[model samples]
Target: MTASSEARETALLAAQAAADKLATDVAIVDVSERLAITDAFVLASAPNERQVQAIVDEVEERLRQHGVKPVRREGVAESRWVLLDFVDVVVHVQHAEERAYYALERLWKDCPTIPFVDRAAPQGDAAAPGTATLSADDIDPASADPTPLAPAPGDGATAGGGPLQDEDPSAPEAAGR
Candidate 1:
């Protein structure tokens, strides 16, 4: 099944809001066929934590203006990656480094992307929004790194060869007999 019209509207609004904040690599992936959780995923990246937060704020504010509020929010503390879940749509605003490392688009490459043209931009200009197409090159130059990433010290390695995750000392370990 494809994304519902309501979901597409929400995703487009979120994408446009991110673009207004100068978020890079803004694209909306139609994931309804793959995931039941949401109809679409709006992926956007910023060069730093501050810009990441800015994009997230804009998305939330813009959607809220349309009487659509996110049902949940995650990763706001560090602002490296923030997820705003709006039930029918989910918006992911990530830092450039995290964006390159995670590569959400690659993960959803099989899905189709919805074109976004900033309503605020004028028509027929190369610098205008409609003329720009989201591409991997626009994500981050680091995404092109040929060298495989090594797990950070003390972090476990995943089968994918990426850092599994940082060990959280505060979390309790499993019980032993």
Candidate 2:
């Protein structure tokens, strides 16, 4: 692999390691060859604001330990979305709600998803030294079907219909009754 590719991979792995250390949900998307700015994007989601900050801190600390520094950082105050830009790679740490709202996955859906080896699972049934036992199904979202909920009808419109609803507000009241 080219030096740039190697460096991108190293950054991706480092970000993944940082995410694993914080037990955050993470994904890496390769956008190097496609995008002009970055090579890869490390997306991670935390359960809450605190965890979001923790994940961001862990990622920065871990990458810094490896002599990698982010060129710029954003969205740390609200802790909803923390972006770490390493020039070649960009790491995003977001709260679950914020992640859903922004939908980075959808934004970069066109980019190819890189499959990484699952090292979080336990090695054999026998417990090994310093090894934590985890089921293969634990971290694999593919193991189950995530049923999509249909959007509520007329959600975008007013409760009764539109402007006419105000003229006949009693209609909605009667329906509810």
Candidate 3:
């Protein structure tokens, strides 16, 4: 295989290892030629804030073991969404609610989605086009509404503001931009 292909495969494997360690749902997207930021995106979802943080830690640890370090990280404080910026592969570990709110899969619908094999899945049950299924475990009960997570006290954000007035269900940003 070409060097690039090998790199892609290695990155995917690394991501899978990290996901397994954290027990989160993972998806990889190949956007090599379509975007400026990176060639691949590894998206994962955790059940809650603690899991999100754990997943991010695992991802960083696994990648570091491979001599790959993220150039930057964002949203670590909120744990709603954490972005790990590797030069060629970007990892996104989000809380279930945030994952549902920003559906990265739909945003990059045109790109091919790399199958994310759960460590628990039987051999050969990895994802395939038009065959992906969402189990009950994947759904976040809190994301049904459009409201953002309430800020902590002293943050000055009021309750009951409701969903953003301009929220667009069809927009990429709505799905995790």
| The candidate that achieves the highest TM-score relative to the unseen native structure | 1
Model 1, residue 54: what's the lDDT? 91
Estimate the overall C-alpha local distance difference test score of candidate 3. 0.71
Residue-wise C-alpha lDDT for candidate 2, range 1-177, written one tens digit per residue: 222665566556655665566545567788866788777888777778888888778788878878888889999998888888888888888888888899888998988765543366446657642344567666654345454333367553443343333345467654563
TM-score of each: 0.70, 0.63, 0.64
Winner by lDDT: 1
For model 1 the TM-score comes to 0.70
Query: Which digits, one per residue and each the tens of the lDDT, describe model 3 over residues 1-177?
Result: 112564476567656765566645577888776787577888888788888888788788877887888789999999989998887788888888888898988898888766556554445546542234677778774665556667665553334433344566567765563
The global Cα lDDT (0 to 1) of model 2 is: 0.69
Off by over 4 Å in 2: 1-3, 123-177
lDDT of each: 0.86, 0.69, 0.71
Better-scoring candidate (TM-score), 1 or 3: 1
Cα displacement (angstroms), candidate 3, residue 129, comes to: 12
Shift of residue 118 alpha carbon in model 3, Å = 3.1
Residue 2 in model 3: lDDT: 18
